[model samples]
Target: MLGATLVSAFSLAGCGEEKAGAQLQGPPPAPVRAAVLERKDVPLRYEYVGQTEGSRSVEVRARVQGLLLKRTYREGAFVREGDVLFLIDPEKYRASSAQTGGELAALRAKLEQTRLEHNRISDLFAKGVVSAKERDDAFAAYDSAKANVAAAEAKMQSEQLDLGYTQVRAPISGITSQEVRSEGSLITTDSAGSLLTTITQLDPLYVNFAIPGTESMQVRRQAQEGKVVVPAEGYSVRLKLADGSVFEQAGRLTFEDRYVDPSTGSIRARAEISNVKAQVLPGEFVRVLLDGALMKDAIVIPERAVLFSQNGPMVYVIGEGDVAELRPVTLGQGVTGGLVVESGLEAGQRIVVDGIMKVRPGGAVSVIPEPEAGGEGKPVAAGKEQSAGNGGVN
Candidate 1:
């Protein structure tokens, strides 16, 4: 009898311990945040590598041939229109202009004397005191003197123009480049030696990029099929710097090549942006973002909710009974905050957005709807009492 009582007491203690353990492990369900899918129009954006250039690049050249006396503007400095850039020796041009002016004055004095002679001859002829031949000769001399004065006047004007060209001035307002020919160099008016420097306008910068021909054709097909809607006004451009910072100013499309490059298989495109502060430099590389295309009636989800497997991308769909079901999804281009769902998902379905790691197919999950900004947080539905299974997407 003592042995029986001792065995019974030990069995009761074991049962009580088992019951306690079961109680401690109450109905465990994976806690996760989910969002109801909705179909809405979302904007599409395309990204590509690009490079910047000046809106206007001009070569500063010398118009007259002479020795470069000195450079007036500093190299790599911002210069205004009509600002003096260099000085050429003007002594020869000045002397020629003075000599032409003296010749013009002498011819004008001769014209006056000839006119007086012609007038005196006309009066004598009217009084029959001189021959008609003499009067005709006087008139011819007066006309010849006047022609000489006119020719000398034109020569003087030409010399003056050459004198003015000695002082080289900027043709446009822009940032200047380094001097190609320094001071004391013999400058020439020919094409080979005329280039003095370069000037680039920086207020409105051009960003050049290329789009693959295949991608462009695909977009056109999609547009015709009613899957994509392009903006009528055209795309708005934004830039991302190498440091991953967005540019402050926005831009618009300026040019698009009609034909694809045979070598690169891409069509060149360009955009113009206002860079009043001169923040963007020419020849700098950047990332181009083309905005203004709309995806029609598309389903989107958070990037964190996406899971990858050997098959493709998958997502956890909260089905009936608040059970997490793994569904394979086809993804399209990414939108502002999430990715567009191409297929295998629909509107009015809930998917796991947060705590995806703890979810398993056919396992109960406590569904917490993502809280709106500045709103109270609460669980959308309490999961059924079930064990948290260990199975997950591979």
Candidate 2:
């Protein structure tokens, strides 16, 4: 009993000594830069460089041969359909029109005379005062006169059409380019007349860009494999202009090229965007955002907050009592906002964004108050570093 009492007393003394030593060696809490984490919907966007084009383009051409007497529409101005653009010399056309009218009038008079003779001959035949051959001749002359009148009327209609053609009108409503043929410029029904001016329809503009076919095929494979989802609304697009500004209007994916280019292995795609202000001009290069589908329920963290240890990629998660817990995380891709945390982090958790060097696993930490909007916590996407090459063509 005496020996057992001594043994218990020694154990108590040993525990006290170890506890004192631990207190002496314990380190102070490390100060860390941290961010409050949130779980929310993030857009999975695909960006590409693309150029713009007018939705519809037409070139005005002269259809008839004439001296370009006068131009009616202002050069490089908006023109409406059926608006007169040019006027060829109408004097020659008017003279031809008058000649056709005179020819028709003369033919009508001859037809009237022939009809009278035919009627008179028929009456003579009924009275037995003329031969049958004489009556037949009068009837044939009347038919020939009727045919002559028809021919003359056709010629008169042709002349009127030619006169109308002298006034060249706009085929469609659009912004016209500079006039190529000016007044007194002889316009012929040849190549010179055919290359008049170009008009561009600009209410809705087309943005044309090409994605490598292999990348597109890879996206399809992912969708089929159920790795990523494509929205029911299909794909939508937005643009970044040359000035690094987001365009006011959004666009829709309109077409995909059926054939891939052998040289570049890219398939062209077009997006139609409303250019109501003419802000997006044709043939201008713009940043194209193709995939805008939401990635439901994602965890995003800053790149600095993520670190690598022997355990692979890890983040220092701040827990209760401001204790730092090193957690291994799987990342999606580095995005403009931040790196996506696929696993090992939850919403409402705090993680160190900066000053991680002073932190250690299971150590107490002091978190600096995060700044307000546009603060240091804002994530900058490492665009090129993103996995799958900026999320691939999807």
Candidate 3:
């Protein structure tokens, strides 16, 4: 009986020591909140710096050379098409026109006299009353007289046109700039001297920008692979002014260059926006936001789950047996909810969002599923708190 009691005591002591040793050997699995990823089509947007310009920028110039007699329109004011902007000295042109008119009248009278003589001579030649040479001379004189009359008529028309050009008119309805030549200044019909003012139409403004070639290629490749869906109607554009306020009017992409610009290595593009109010001025810099692009079947995760290390951006994924596995992911654009996973993730995988610091590769974890709504999705034993708004570089 004594021997049996001693053996029993030793066995109990060994069992107790074994239990205590097991308790102190390692810690329990880390409690982390994880979420299962799902694939869905998500909208995408891109932004670029653009410049505002008038749809039509016209340099008003004088067509006729003369002294600038007067400027009819106010400087820096809106003017309508065909409105008289300037008056050049019309005295010389008027005198030239009058001279041409008088010469035309004399030529017409001479042509009539030659015609009557030619008819009488033709009748005489047919009746054998005149020689063939005489008849030919009469016909030649009549032809010469007609030619003179036509030449005089042409000169008269040109003179009248010059007289009309004395009054410089606005070619388009737009805002006009200051006069290049003041009244009494000589305005010549030459490249350097003809400029009277500049007119810029601001009703429909143009916004110009460029797209990088690399990004353009990537988008095309993704679209061909069924990874992206570009809208059929083209991208919808919005402008953000320099003051950080979004323009009330929206625009559309109107033009894109066929070839990439060699200097910039980007494709030139343009957008048209309604600027009836003239709120946006020309030559101003603005931010252009392009929308209506979609990412097809994309996997997104909360940005807080992403951890940056020397190796790159990585996340803690729950593997088989609820073990944490470190996964490297390629990031794309940021969306409203989180960052898009370009690669290195799949649907149905659980990623640790909250208590991310507590997760270790190859370590066991107790996954508490993230809630659908409300709460921080914190585990009972929280590690370090992380906000879901943290973003990775796109």
Candidate 4:
């Protein structure tokens, strides 16, 4: 009986120790990072890749046929309207003009002689001093001389225009390209390959881009319904270059195509921006950002907090006791660094911003201050914070 009691007491003590050990080994605290929910303004913007094009572009070509004698303007140099760009061999044209002028002068003298003879013949015919045939022959000669004079005058005018054409002048004020035909190269008026140079006006530039048909349709429908407010005077637009630098000057949306591209199923739009400094060039690829629409009370969350699941998009929300609760969400347009949640979740909910992978549903989470990015946490401005906060959940 004494041995039995001692064994039973020892077993009870072992059980108590095991139970204490098990109780001490509680569930580990969830490693998590979080972000505060604040209300702030979030400007809705759409990003699209576009290309820059000059507002005006023209190709310069030789108008008259001649030997290219001189290039007056330097290649790739800015030129003014009426600036001489090329000097074709004017000698041939000059000779032709001179010959025509001389002939015209000679014809003028002959015309004077014909007039005098006609006057004399009219007097003789009136006085009946000469035979009818003689008078008629004199009149015919005078008429022929008058016709010759008219022909010569017309020829002179034609030759003068041809001579003027030898000096190729710029039709518009813009930059000039390299000489396609070098000096002494023969060029013709009707040559199939007569491209001389190209000029593009680059002060104010145009940005051409396409928006997906669905997005465009939404914009159009909203605009028609008067539910969305587009800028009345000038809609603001921002540009992103191929190198990812944002352009300094803001642009305006000037045009939208009436038809959608059949192949791409996108609608084209154009924005005009002042590039007086020649910052934007033709054929440069860029991105255009249009900003105007405002959501009064929209909910937004940091993009990192949103997770893609087979079920749909979801985010982990910290509930009553810092417990993670996975909530499926519907997302709207994405803004910079975050997404606009159309549904699910609510305002004032703590979201795991960092260390998301370490937490699971119903898991305990410790709310710690997010480490300052870089050296210091960027101070959220008063109104801006509210705007940003509203972007997550109302």
Show the lowest summed lDDT stretch of 10 residues, model 4: 382-391
Better of 3 and 4 by TM-score: 3
Model 3, position 345, has a per-residue lDDT of 93
Name model 4 segments beyond 4 Å from true: 1-25, 31-41, 99-158, 191-193, 221-228, 368-394
Decreasing lDDT order of the candidates: 3, 1, 2, 4
- Model 2 segments beyond 4 Å from truth? 1-28, 32-41, 111-143, 303-337, 341-350, 354-364, 367-394
The lDDT per prediction is 0.87, 0.80, 0.88, 0.79
Name the 10 consecutive residues with the lowest summed lDDT in model 1.
382-391
Instruction: Estimate the TM-score for candidate 1.
Output: 0.85
TM-score each candidate: 0.85, 0.71, 0.74, 0.73
What shift in Å separates residue 11 of candidate 4 from its native position after superposition? 11
Question: 1-394 in candidate 3: lDDT tens per residue?
Answer: 9999999999999999999999886676777766777888899888899999999999999999999999999997888899999999999999999999999999999999999999999999999999999999999999999999999999999999999999999999888888888999999988999999999999799999999998899999999999999999999999999999999999999998889889999999999999988899899999999999999988888888899899989999888998889999999888767899989999878778877777678888776533336845643322222233323212
lDDT of 1 by residue, 1-394 (tens): 9999999999999999999999987556777767778788888999989999999999999988999999999998989889999999999899999988888999999999999999999999999999999999999999999999989988998899999999999988889999999999999999989899999998899999999999999889989999899989999999999889999999998898999999999999999999988898899999999999998888888898899999999999988889889999999878887898989998878888777888788888875443445755544432211221233222
* Candidate 3: Cα lDDT at 103: 92
All candidates in order of TM-score, best leading = 1, 3, 4, 2
Q: Which window of ten consecutive residues has the lowest lDDT sum in model 2? A: 384-393
lDDT score for candidate 2 against the true structure = 0.80
Q: Give the lDDT of residue 266 in candidate 1.
A: 100
Q: Which candidate is the best by TM-score?
A: 1
Root-mean-square deviation of candidate 2? 9.9
What's the CA error at residue 225 for candidate 3, in Å? 1.9
